[model samples]
Target: MTSPGGAAGTRTDPTGTPHPDPTWGPLYRAGAWSALLFVLLVLVPVVLVVVAPLPPTRGAALLEYIAQHRVVYLTELVSFVGLAVPAMVVFAAVAVALKGVDQSIAAIGGLFGVASEVIALALGSSPQSLHGGLVVLSNAYRAADATDRPALASAAEALIAATNAVSWAGILTAAAILLLSLPMRRASFFGPVLSTLGVLAGAAGIVSEALRPVIGSGYMLYGLLLPIWFAIVGWKLLHVSTARAS
Candidate 1:
């Protein structure tokens, strides 16, 4: 049986094992607004651009730059910390909102979204791994004679390979957006046009990330599309009245 005043099949949680809660509707909308602000202010600008800057030079030169500019290193750590909490909340919020319409798709999409953030946070910071590797390599290269060149190069190559492995997180995030957008397309707030854009953004992200090796820095293209998609969704959520959500 359905909870009083709740639409049939609305569950209290994404797992759908418990009773439905009509009250969660407003909470999901509020979470959407919070996520929107995070995308606009933090994720797009600081996490993407600042934390992941273009390498001015490859090999020794790049290492040297990283060693000298400690701020870049520190910023990477800070970005991960700053992004972790909001990212989790936003994705969870998206999950809750999506569940209101399509529970199965929402559950899958939410997992993908969470995986994306978790991978980034898990690998992005650890001084002993990527961050520490950079500093250690830079310092070693600085002190090493010509005879040690080959060893340093090999180590750097290994580290770079490991770094690229994290790109799959982007693919997961794209999948989440694509799945979430499907239900939004049917919603009155998103409609066809904005929902179509959301679909396009997700598709672009998937393609860009998949072809990253071939296209080099082409994955950055999603940066342009995603903000717009996020803004549209966030705006709709922000303006949606509590009564409508309930």
Candidate 2:
């Protein structure tokens, strides 16, 4: 059998191949931090804004709520827009870290992950558009007569629905990262547990997202585990990489 790649003093298998090196600690750490940022900056804000009582489902209630909470909606829109940059960094870091183990899988998986995120961001609401829509709604709510309110409410619903459509992209990104775990299972840098968890979590996550419309939000339980898994894997990668360097 061929040896895994590693540092000068690293032990080799019976065939005299060194283990794969975890020399990419910095990249892993960066990936971890970026992933955490996605949780904090993008995910958290989304959850808060969505789960909040900013608007009830009824038409007049929703209009009144948006009029009262325009700032909150504006802030959430800005947060979503800002997510694109950190998301790119997170995917790129993951790809580089994976490259340290297996290059081909990393390239393909990483490219797909980044592409998924980009597509989601592109197809989703833009900050300016969201902000503009909110401005129009707020102004219309304040100035429009009772007869005009229905059109404004319809516009608001359309905007919210458009934003919600991007949820699939998040699932696709998770699936792409999990694909790299297939190689991680065999690589010396990461063993069976991480890879196994990656696959399970990824699969569950994909299912959760796919069934979300049907389940009516129950899938978030599985969805929430995704970031936690990422954080754990990232932490392990950082530790192992630093250890290898020493």
Which candidate number would show the highest TM-score if scored against the true structure?
Answer: 2
Model 1 clashing residue pairs (backbone): none
Residue 77 shift from truth in candidate 2, angstroms:
3.9
Give per-residue CA lDDT, model 1, range 192-213, as digits (tens).
Answer: 7876886888898899777755
Q: For candidate 2, which ten residues in a row score worst on lDDT?
A: 1-10
Question: Residue 55 in candidate 1 has what lDDT?
Answer: 51
- Estimated TM-score for each candidate: 0.72, 0.74
What local lDDT does model 2 show for residue 136? 64
Instruction: In angstroms, give how far residue 46 of model 1 lies from its true place.
Output: 6.9
- The 0-to-1 C-alpha lDDT of every candidate, in the order given, reads 0.62, 0.63
lDDT of 1: 0.62
